[model samples]
Target: MKNNLDLTQFDFKKDLPDWQVDLITKTLSRNFVFKDFEAAFAFMTLCAAYAEKIDHHPDWSNSWNQVKVQLRTHSKNDITPLDIELAKAMDAFANQIQKPAEI
Candidate 1:
Protein backbone atom coordinates (compact mmCIF):
# COMPACT_ATOMS: atom_id res chain seq x y z
CA MET A 1 0.00 0.00 0.00
CA LYS A 2 1.15 3.52 -0.74
CA ASN A 3 0.02 6.99 0.20
CA ASN A 4 1.31 10.46 1.01
CA LEU A 5 -0.06 10.62 4.55
CA ASP A 6 2.32 10.67 7.46
CA LEU A 7 1.41 7.51 9.31
CA THR A 8 4.17 7.80 11.87
CA GLN A 9 2.42 10.54 13.79
CA PHE A 10 -0.78 8.52 14.10
CA ASP A 11 -1.08 5.89 16.78
CA PHE A 12 -3.73 3.88 15.00
CA LYS A 13 -4.48 1.60 17.93
CA LYS A 14 -5.24 4.50 20.26
CA ASP A 15 -6.34 7.10 17.72
CA LEU A 16 -9.06 4.94 16.23
CA PRO A 17 -9.79 2.52 19.02
CA ASP A 18 -13.07 1.47 17.51
CA TRP A 19 -11.87 1.12 13.92
CA GLN A 20 -10.11 -1.68 12.15
CA VAL A 21 -7.45 -1.04 9.56
CA ASP A 22 -6.65 -3.96 7.31
CA LEU A 23 -3.31 -3.66 5.66
CA ILE A 24 -4.05 -6.51 3.31
CA THR A 25 -7.03 -4.58 2.01
CA LYS A 26 -5.60 -1.13 2.64
CA THR A 27 -8.85 0.10 4.10
CA LEU A 28 -10.18 1.39 7.40
CA SER A 29 -13.44 -0.22 8.41
CA ARG A 30 -16.03 -0.25 11.18
CA ASN A 31 -19.59 -1.32 11.80
CA PHE A 32 -21.90 1.11 13.56
CA VAL A 33 -25.15 -0.01 15.09
CA PHE A 34 -27.87 2.42 16.06
CA LYS A 35 -31.12 2.10 17.98
CA ASP A 36 -33.25 1.83 14.82
CA PHE A 37 -33.43 2.24 11.07
CA GLU A 38 -34.24 5.92 11.29
CA ALA A 39 -31.28 6.50 13.52
CA ALA A 40 -29.08 4.54 11.16
CA PHE A 41 -30.28 6.55 8.17
CA ALA A 42 -29.79 9.73 10.12
CA PHE A 43 -26.17 8.80 10.72
CA MET A 44 -25.68 8.09 7.06
CA THR A 45 -27.26 11.40 6.12
CA LEU A 46 -24.91 13.27 8.41
CA CYS A 47 -21.93 11.39 7.03
CA ALA A 48 -23.04 12.07 3.48
CA ALA A 49 -23.16 15.79 4.02
CA TYR A 50 -19.75 15.84 5.64
CA ALA A 51 -18.27 13.61 2.99
CA GLU A 52 -19.66 15.87 0.32
CA LYS A 53 -18.12 18.88 1.98
CA ILE A 54 -14.73 17.16 2.11
CA ASP A 55 -15.15 15.78 -1.40
CA HIS A 56 -14.40 12.31 -0.08
CA HIS A 57 -17.04 9.65 0.33
CA PRO A 58 -17.11 6.37 2.21
CA ASP A 59 -17.97 2.94 0.97
CA TRP A 60 -20.91 2.16 3.19
CA SER A 61 -24.14 0.27 3.44
CA ASN A 62 -27.07 0.35 5.81
CA SER A 63 -29.17 -2.59 6.96
CA TRP A 64 -31.96 -1.83 9.34
CA ASN A 65 -29.98 -0.21 12.12
CA GLN A 66 -26.40 -0.88 11.19
CA VAL A 67 -23.95 1.05 9.03
CA LYS A 68 -20.90 -0.74 7.73
CA VAL A 69 -18.19 1.68 6.68
CA GLN A 70 -14.93 1.27 4.79
CA LEU A 71 -12.75 4.25 3.98
CA ARG A 72 -9.70 4.69 1.81
CA THR A 73 -8.21 7.10 -0.68
CA HIS A 74 -8.92 5.33 -3.94
CA SER A 75 -6.61 7.51 -5.97
CA LYS A 76 -3.72 6.67 -3.70
CA ASN A 77 -4.67 3.00 -3.64
CA ASP A 78 -4.25 2.85 0.11
CA ILE A 79 -5.40 4.05 3.49
CA THR A 80 -4.12 7.56 4.03
CA PRO A 81 -4.70 10.58 6.22
CA LEU A 82 -7.98 11.21 4.48
CA ASP A 83 -9.31 7.90 5.67
CA ILE A 84 -8.23 8.66 9.21
CA GLU A 85 -9.86 12.08 9.15
CA LEU A 86 -13.09 10.73 7.77
CA ALA A 87 -13.22 7.91 10.28
CA LYS A 88 -12.77 10.39 13.10
CA ALA A 89 -15.55 12.54 11.75
CA MET A 90 -17.83 9.55 11.39
CA ASP A 91 -17.21 8.51 14.99
CA ALA A 92 -18.01 12.02 16.16
CA PHE A 93 -21.22 12.07 14.15
CA ALA A 94 -22.26 8.73 15.56
CA ASN A 95 -21.81 10.09 19.06
CA GLN A 96 -23.95 13.16 18.35
CA ILE A 97 -27.02 11.17 17.29
CA GLN A 98 -27.03 8.92 20.33
CA LYS A 99 -24.93 7.42 23.08
CA PRO A 100 -22.45 5.82 20.71
CA ALA A 101 -22.21 3.20 18.01
CA GLU A 102 -21.84 -0.46 18.89
CA ILE A 103 -18.66 -1.99 17.56
Candidate 2:
Protein backbone atom coordinates (compact mmCIF):
# COMPACT_ATOMS: atom_id res chain seq x y z
CA MET A 1 0.00 0.00 0.00
CA LYS A 2 1.12 3.50 -0.70
CA ASN A 3 2.21 5.43 2.33
CA ASN A 4 -0.66 7.72 3.26
CA LEU A 5 1.98 10.25 4.21
CA ASP A 6 2.92 10.59 0.56
CA LEU A 7 0.95 13.46 -0.98
CA THR A 8 1.79 12.50 -4.53
CA GLN A 9 -1.76 11.22 -4.67
CA PHE A 10 -2.88 12.34 -1.26
CA ASP A 11 -6.59 12.91 -0.87
CA PHE A 12 -7.64 16.21 0.75
CA LYS A 13 -11.28 15.80 -0.22
CA LYS A 14 -12.55 15.60 3.32
CA ASP A 15 -11.13 18.85 4.64
CA LEU A 16 -9.65 20.72 1.73
CA PRO A 17 -11.71 19.39 -1.14
CA ASP A 18 -10.88 22.44 -3.21
CA TRP A 19 -7.21 21.49 -3.32
CA GLN A 20 -6.04 19.02 -5.93
CA VAL A 21 -2.94 16.84 -5.68
CA ASP A 22 -1.01 16.28 -8.87
CA LEU A 23 1.10 13.13 -9.04
CA ILE A 24 3.20 14.43 -11.90
CA THR A 25 4.12 17.58 -9.99
CA LYS A 26 3.89 16.06 -6.53
CA THR A 27 2.21 19.16 -5.16
CA LEU A 28 -1.12 20.31 -3.83
CA SER A 29 -2.56 23.21 -5.78
CA ARG A 30 -5.56 25.48 -5.79
CA ASN A 31 -6.67 28.55 -7.68
CA PHE A 32 -8.40 31.30 -5.74
CA VAL A 33 -10.53 33.96 -7.41
CA PHE A 34 -11.63 37.20 -5.86
CA LYS A 35 -14.09 39.89 -6.85
CA ASP A 36 -11.29 42.27 -7.75
CA PHE A 37 -7.56 42.81 -7.83
CA GLU A 38 -7.51 44.48 -4.44
CA ALA A 39 -9.22 41.56 -2.79
CA ALA A 40 -6.86 39.11 -4.43
CA PHE A 41 -3.85 41.11 -3.36
CA ALA A 42 -5.15 41.29 0.15
CA PHE A 43 -5.50 37.53 0.24
CA MET A 44 -1.96 37.05 -1.00
CA THR A 45 -0.55 39.53 1.48
CA LEU A 46 -2.18 37.71 4.36
CA CYS A 47 -0.92 34.34 3.22
CA ALA A 48 2.56 35.68 2.54
CA ALA A 49 2.92 36.94 6.09
CA TYR A 50 1.84 33.62 7.55
CA ALA A 51 4.08 31.63 5.23
CA GLU A 52 7.02 33.82 6.10
CA LYS A 53 6.37 33.41 9.80
CA ILE A 54 6.30 29.62 9.41
CA ASP A 55 9.32 29.64 7.08
CA HIS A 56 7.48 27.43 4.60
CA HIS A 57 6.85 29.48 1.53
CA PRO A 58 4.64 28.26 -1.26
CA ASP A 59 4.99 28.41 -5.01
CA TRP A 60 2.29 30.81 -6.07
CA SER A 61 1.32 33.42 -8.59
CA ASN A 62 -1.11 36.27 -8.72
CA SER A 63 -2.80 37.79 -11.74
CA TRP A 64 -5.28 40.58 -11.21
CA ASN A 65 -8.17 38.89 -9.47
CA GLN A 66 -6.77 35.45 -8.98
CA VAL A 67 -3.97 33.65 -7.17
CA LYS A 68 -2.75 30.16 -7.96
CA VAL A 69 -0.79 28.24 -5.35
CA GLN A 70 1.20 25.03 -5.19
CA LEU A 71 2.52 23.60 -1.94
CA ARG A 72 5.48 21.28 -1.60
CA THR A 73 8.51 20.92 0.62
CA HIS A 74 11.37 21.70 -1.76
CA SER A 75 14.00 20.33 0.60
CA LYS A 76 12.35 16.94 0.69
CA ASN A 77 11.08 17.23 -2.89
CA ASP A 78 7.74 16.05 -1.54
CA ILE A 79 4.71 17.24 0.35
CA THR A 80 4.94 17.22 4.12
CA PRO A 81 3.24 18.50 7.26
CA LEU A 82 4.48 21.99 6.49
CA ASP A 83 2.59 21.99 3.22
CA ILE A 84 -0.53 20.89 5.01
CA GLU A 85 -0.14 23.67 7.54
CA LEU A 86 0.37 26.25 4.84
CA ALA A 87 -2.52 24.94 2.83
CA LYS A 88 -4.87 25.08 5.78
CA ALA A 89 -3.77 28.58 6.65
CA MET A 90 -4.17 29.71 3.05
CA ASP A 91 -7.68 28.31 2.91
CA ALA A 92 -8.64 30.28 5.96
CA PHE A 93 -7.09 33.47 4.67
CA ALA A 94 -8.81 33.17 1.31
CA ASN A 95 -12.12 32.37 2.94
CA GLN A 96 -11.88 35.46 5.11
CA ILE A 97 -11.22 37.67 2.12
CA GLN A 98 -13.89 36.07 -0.02
CA LYS A 99 -16.61 36.54 2.51
CA PRO A 100 -19.40 38.84 1.34
CA ALA A 101 -19.67 42.24 2.90
CA GLU A 102 -22.38 42.79 5.48
CA ILE A 103 -25.19 45.18 4.75
Candidate 3:
Protein backbone atom coordinates (compact mmCIF):
# COMPACT_ATOMS: atom_id res chain seq x y z
CA MET A 1 0.00 0.00 0.00
CA LYS A 2 1.14 3.52 -0.71
CA ASN A 3 2.04 5.62 2.28
CA ASN A 4 -0.17 8.42 0.95
CA LEU A 5 -3.39 6.47 0.98
CA ASP A 6 -6.00 8.37 2.98
CA LEU A 7 -6.81 5.93 5.69
CA THR A 8 -8.85 8.59 7.42
CA GLN A 9 -11.45 8.65 4.67
CA PHE A 10 -11.06 5.35 2.85
CA ASP A 11 -9.81 1.83 2.83
CA PHE A 12 -7.34 0.81 0.12
CA LYS A 13 -9.52 -2.12 -0.90
CA LYS A 14 -13.05 -1.32 0.16
CA ASP A 15 -14.00 2.31 -0.52
CA LEU A 16 -14.41 1.85 -4.24
CA PRO A 17 -15.77 -0.91 -6.45
CA ASP A 18 -13.35 -3.61 -7.48
CA TRP A 19 -13.03 -2.34 -11.01
CA GLN A 20 -12.44 1.25 -9.99
CA VAL A 21 -9.87 0.09 -7.52
CA ASP A 22 -8.03 -1.80 -10.23
CA LEU A 23 -8.21 1.06 -12.64
CA ILE A 24 -7.48 4.11 -10.50
CA THR A 25 -6.32 3.24 -7.03
CA LYS A 26 -2.73 4.29 -7.38
CA THR A 27 -2.81 6.05 -10.73
CA LEU A 28 -6.20 7.60 -11.05
CA SER A 29 -7.33 8.33 -14.57
CA ARG A 30 -10.57 8.95 -16.43
CA ASN A 31 -11.43 10.37 -19.81
CA PHE A 32 -14.50 12.39 -20.76
CA VAL A 33 -15.68 13.49 -24.16
CA PHE A 34 -18.15 16.11 -25.18
CA LYS A 35 -19.72 17.49 -28.33
CA ASP A 36 -17.07 20.15 -28.76
CA PHE A 37 -14.50 22.25 -27.00
CA GLU A 38 -17.24 24.41 -25.60
CA ALA A 39 -18.96 21.53 -23.94
CA ALA A 40 -15.76 19.99 -22.73
CA PHE A 41 -14.66 23.22 -21.15
CA ALA A 42 -18.05 23.75 -19.65
CA PHE A 43 -17.80 20.41 -17.95
CA MET A 44 -14.35 21.20 -16.68
CA THR A 45 -15.49 24.49 -15.24
CA LEU A 46 -18.31 22.84 -13.41
CA CYS A 47 -16.01 20.18 -12.07
CA ALA A 48 -13.57 22.83 -10.99
CA ALA A 49 -16.22 24.51 -8.93
CA TYR A 50 -17.12 21.22 -7.35
CA ALA A 51 -13.51 20.50 -6.56
CA GLU A 52 -13.11 23.90 -5.00
CA LYS A 53 -16.24 23.46 -2.95
CA ILE A 54 -14.82 20.26 -1.59
CA ASP A 55 -11.33 21.67 -1.18
CA HIS A 56 -9.90 18.92 -3.38
CA HIS A 57 -8.12 19.29 -6.65
CA PRO A 58 -7.67 16.94 -9.59
CA ASP A 59 -4.92 16.58 -12.13
CA TRP A 60 -6.42 17.16 -15.56
CA SER A 61 -5.83 18.12 -19.14
CA ASN A 62 -8.20 19.21 -21.86
CA SER A 63 -7.95 19.19 -25.60
CA TRP A 64 -10.37 20.37 -28.23
CA ASN A 65 -13.18 18.12 -27.17
CA GLN A 66 -11.93 15.83 -24.51
CA VAL A 67 -10.83 16.03 -20.92
CA LYS A 68 -8.62 13.60 -19.07
CA VAL A 69 -8.65 13.67 -15.30
CA GLN A 70 -6.78 11.92 -12.54
CA LEU A 71 -7.74 12.20 -8.92
CA ARG A 72 -5.80 11.19 -5.86
CA THR A 73 -4.54 12.51 -2.59
CA HIS A 74 -1.06 13.73 -3.27
CA SER A 75 -0.23 13.65 0.38
CA LYS A 76 -0.95 9.96 0.32
CA ASN A 77 0.01 9.20 -3.28
CA ASP A 78 -3.14 7.08 -3.62
CA ILE A 79 -6.82 7.28 -4.25
CA THR A 80 -9.13 8.19 -1.41
CA PRO A 81 -12.85 8.54 -0.96
CA LEU A 82 -12.43 12.16 -2.08
CA ASP A 83 -11.12 10.92 -5.41
CA ILE A 84 -13.98 8.49 -5.82
CA GLU A 85 -16.49 11.14 -4.94
CA LEU A 86 -15.01 13.67 -7.35
CA ALA A 87 -14.92 11.12 -10.17
CA LYS A 88 -18.59 10.43 -9.66
CA ALA A 89 -19.33 14.12 -9.53
CA MET A 90 -17.52 14.72 -12.78
CA ASP A 91 -19.37 11.85 -14.41
CA ALA A 92 -22.68 13.22 -13.29
CA PHE A 93 -21.79 16.70 -14.47
CA ALA A 94 -20.79 15.38 -17.88
CA ASN A 95 -24.01 13.42 -18.17
CA GLN A 96 -26.01 16.45 -17.24
CA ILE A 97 -24.33 18.75 -19.75
CA GLN A 98 -23.56 16.38 -22.60
CA LYS A 99 -25.27 17.23 -25.84
CA PRO A 100 -25.74 15.05 -28.87
CA ALA A 101 -23.65 15.91 -31.88
CA GLU A 102 -25.20 17.46 -34.94
CA ILE A 103 -24.96 15.48 -38.12
Q: Give the best candidate by TM-score.
A: 1
Model 2 TM: 0.87
TM-score versus the correct structure, for each prediction: 0.88, 0.87, 0.73
Pairs of residues at least 3 apart in sequence or in different chains that clash in candidate 3: 4-76
CA lDDT of each prediction against the hidden true structure:
0.88, 0.86, 0.75
Off by over 4 Å in 1: 1-3, 100-103
**Each candidate: how many clashes?**
0, 0, 1
Question: Please, what are the lDDT tens digits per residue for candidate 2 over residues 25-45?
Answer: 778999999999999999999
From the highest lDDT down, the ranking of the candidates is 1, 2, 3
lDDT of 2 at 24: 73
**Per-residue alpha-carbon lDDT of candidate 3 for residues 39-86, written as tens digits (9 for 90 to 100):** 998999999999999999988999999998877778866666677778
Indicate the worst ten consecutive residues by lDDT in candidate 2. 1-10
- For candidate 1, which ten residues in a row score worst on lDDT? 1-10
> lDDT score, residue 64, model 3?
99
Query: Per-residue error at 80 for model 2, in Å?
Result: 0.4
Model 1 lDDT tens row, 59-103: 999999999999988888888877888899999999998875569
